[model samples]
Target: MSDNYTKIVQQNLHKLYTKLPPDLERNLPGHRNGQEFMFNAFGEKCTITPRAITLGDANYPAIHGILISLYALNATPEICLLSPFKSFREFPDSMPYVGAFTTHTEQLLEPHVPDIRKSAALITRYFNGEDVPVQGGGDFAFTLFPLPKIALCYIFYEADEDFPASVKCLFSNNANRFLPIDGLADVGEYTSKKIVDLICDVNSPS
Candidate 1:
């Protein structure tokens, strides 16, 4: 990566990370006590774990950065980083792929998963009306480019207010609604076979 690219990624990551509140830094465990933070969860539960949050039980915060990091690891410059919210004035067509993802998330995917519909609606709104500029972060596009743009919403355990209680609720309620934090075995099983295959390859050794 160029010094400029690295610099930009570093700066933006810092900008975003600083926004994280105490919960992200919290050492608390889940009601299950067996559970861990969304990102920290491994094997099967990793994908299901809601994202980390900010305030009021908070919302998932680290998702975009990590996705961008994946994109940076795999994609090229022509493809932009897309989020639902865009500052397109500066980004132009080169905006990141996250926005395209938002559409997939709301229009096609969320409707199929009503259990999390309320949360999905809110996340959809967050990305709905914007043409924001892309702050080129990491070179994670390599991972993002191969797949169709898909929106990702991180809820964490924020659905509940009390700490471990909320987290337990989060896991219980959405146990079956796990997003592909890193692809689990059946992420896009039928919709796009080719893309799913590619993802599987990426997960496997080249």
Candidate 2:
């Protein structure tokens, strides 16, 4: 079971929620979770609203508003269920960049879909100290960039001989490649570099 990780994350976020205005609190009890958390707020019980932060792109910037929404869900559970929420002024600094995505990313969506399950298995084996290389993992790294956007990122490592089986990974807007389970720090760096190269290549006339 996922244990409603979003809800659990919301619970954790409440402990640190701050800077909420009285009127906004009254308007929309205030949420501190992700997009879903804030969407849960709306209606007669609340009436406060603040402008959303700029997330480079409009429409689907879950990372932009997730922090504030998570807090609202945790701190003001009662009035949060008002109408569709429209405030994200109190977003936090440490909220993860991955947990609050608002939509399917075209950044790395299509190309990476098929790799998810296979890579997951490799991650499991490597983290386990099994020395298993993720399929498609070349001598360098597997820089699998999907279509749309790269909304989610993670790695699975199975327990190894010397170390307990523990999948250690983190989501990063920066990781362009995957680190081989054998030894490496990251995997997404290669993918990102390639993306940059492609951009530069197109721009370079010569």
Best by TM-score: 1
Quickly count the clashes in candidate 2.
54
RMSD of 2: 18.0
Error of 1 at 188 (Å): 13
Give a tens-digit lDDT track for model 1, residues 1-111.
345645555664455344422343132111222222332221012221122221113232243334333322232223222433222112223235334433432233322
Stretches of candidate 1 off by over 4 Å are: 24-206
Deviation from native of the Cα of residue 120 in model 1, angstroms: 23
The residue-level lDDT of candidate 2 at 14 comes to 50
lDDT of 2 at 102: 18
Please write out the lDDT profile of model 2 over residues 1-206, one tens digit for every residue. Answer: 13364454344345334444344333333343432113221101111133332222223213223433433333332321211211111123323433222111223323343333334334323222122233322221221222111211333333348644222122324212211111012122222223333444544689
